[model samples]
Target: MKKSIIYSLIIFLFVLLAGCEKDEPMGYKGRPGVYFNGNEFSYSFAENPWKDIDTVLLPILLTGDLEDYDRKVKAIVVSDSTTATGDMYELLEGTIKAGEETGYVPVVVNSVEELEKSVVRVRVQIVENEYFKELDLVYPACNFTFTAQIIKPYNWSQLEYFFGPYSTGWWKFIMEKLGRTSLPYWDMWSPIPNPDESKYNMSYYEMSNIQQMIRLELADYNKHSTTGPMKHDDGEYAGKEIVVPAPW
Candidate 1:
C-alpha cells in the first residue's frame, strides 16, 4: 500500500509540471509586424503651425520579434474626394530596419488653403510588404486618419464685445503665436525678473504689461483717434497695415 501511494504522488507532480509548460506565454517567436502607435492623429491650422508649413511625425512599431536582418515597412496615404489634396498636404513613405522598435512617417501640411475651404482630413495605412505584415488587430490597425481645422483670427462677432474694432491684426498675431483664442494674462506674466539681459532684459510681468498696454492704446486710438494712457505710446497702425513681428 505504501509503495503504491508514493508512485501515485510522483505521477501527479509530473502532470502538474507538464500543464505549466503548456500554458507558458510565447514571446518573440515570429516575423516582425507593423502597427501605428495610436489610433488617430490631429492638427489644427491655429494650434500647430508657426508658419506656412508644418510636419507631423507618426510612429510605427514592430511586434512579434526583433530580428538580425533589416525589415522594410511600407505605408500609403488613403484618401477620398472629401479628403484634402494638392496644396493641402504631402504624404510620405518610409522603412524600418531590423531590431528597430520604432519608425516614423512624416506627414507635411503644405498649405492651409484647404482648411479655409473646410476641415481637411488625411488618412494613412500600413500594407503588407515582403518583410513586414500589417497588424489589423492593433489599436491603430493597418489604418489611421488625421484631421486638421482652422481655429484662429477670431471673427468680428467673436471679439466685438471686449475689443470692439480694435481686435483685428494684433489679435490674429497673438493667436498665431500663442495658439489659443483667449489670452492667459497671468501665465504670460511672471513676478520673477529675468536675469538674461541679452534675451529681453525685462521680467515676464513687465513684458506682458507692455503688450497689454499696447493693445489698450491701440483700442483707444480706434475709438477716439487719439492715444490712451500708456506711457510707451507707440504710433498705431491700421488693422490691415499691421504686420506680424518676424520673431515673437
Candidate 2:
C-alpha cells in the first residue's frame, strides 16, 4: 500500500508540472496584447513574424498579405507646463515592417518655450519555425517606435526651431505660416521602395533626383500660395493641423 501511494503521488506531480509548462509555453507566437496610454489597444504582427527557424533575409513577409493585413502599433503623447513630448512608438519585437521605416525624435520648438512629453509603445509575438533545428537557427522579434508633436499656432519663432536652419525654402515659408495662424501638421514620413532601385541599377543620382523633385514641388506650391493677397498679408495664415495616418 505504501509503495502504491508513493507511485500515485509521483504521477500526480508530473501531471501538475506539465500543466504549468503548457500555460506559459516558451517562444514567441500567437495573439499579442498591446497597450497605449494605459488603455488596451488592438494590434497584429507578422503572420510569420518570427525568425526562430532562421534569420529572415527576404522581404519581411507578414503573416497576412499586404491588403488583407491589418496591424495596429500602440502609441502615446504626454505634456507638461513648459514642454511637450512628441509621440514615441516602441519596437519591442521584430525588425521594422517591410517598406515602412519610422523614426522617433523629440520635437524642439523655439528655445524650449513650448514643449511636450509623449511616447508610443508596441508589442509582438513570434513562433518557432518547424523547418530548422534550434541548434542552427535564431529567432528575432520585430517592432518599431514613432513620435509626433503639436506645433502651436501662436509660436512663429518655433518654426525655425523645429525644422532647423538649412530648410530655408518652402519649408520655412510653410513653417512660418503654420506657426502664426494655423495648426502645423507634421507627417512622419519615410521613402518607400523605388522600383528602379529594386529592379534596375541603383544609383545615388537616381535617389537624389527623386528628393529634389519633392523639394521643388513643395517650394513651387508655397511660392504660388504666398504670392496671392490676403495669404501672406499678416505673415500669418489660417490652417488646420492635419496629422498623417500611420501605415501599418
Q: Which candidate has the highest lDDT of all?
A: 1
**Each model's Cα RMSD:** 13.3, 20.1
Tens digits of per-residue lDDT for model 1 on 10-88?
9999999998887764544465577776655555555444557866666677777666676666777665522766677
TM-score: which candidate is best? 1
Residue 59 lDDT in candidate 1: 64
List the global CA lDDT of all models: 0.52, 0.29
lDDT of 2 by residue, 176-233 (tens): 4333222222222312222112222424344344334534544555567654422222
Q: Could you give me the TM-score of model 1 versus the true structure? A: 0.49
Worst 10 residues of 1 by lDDT: 191-200
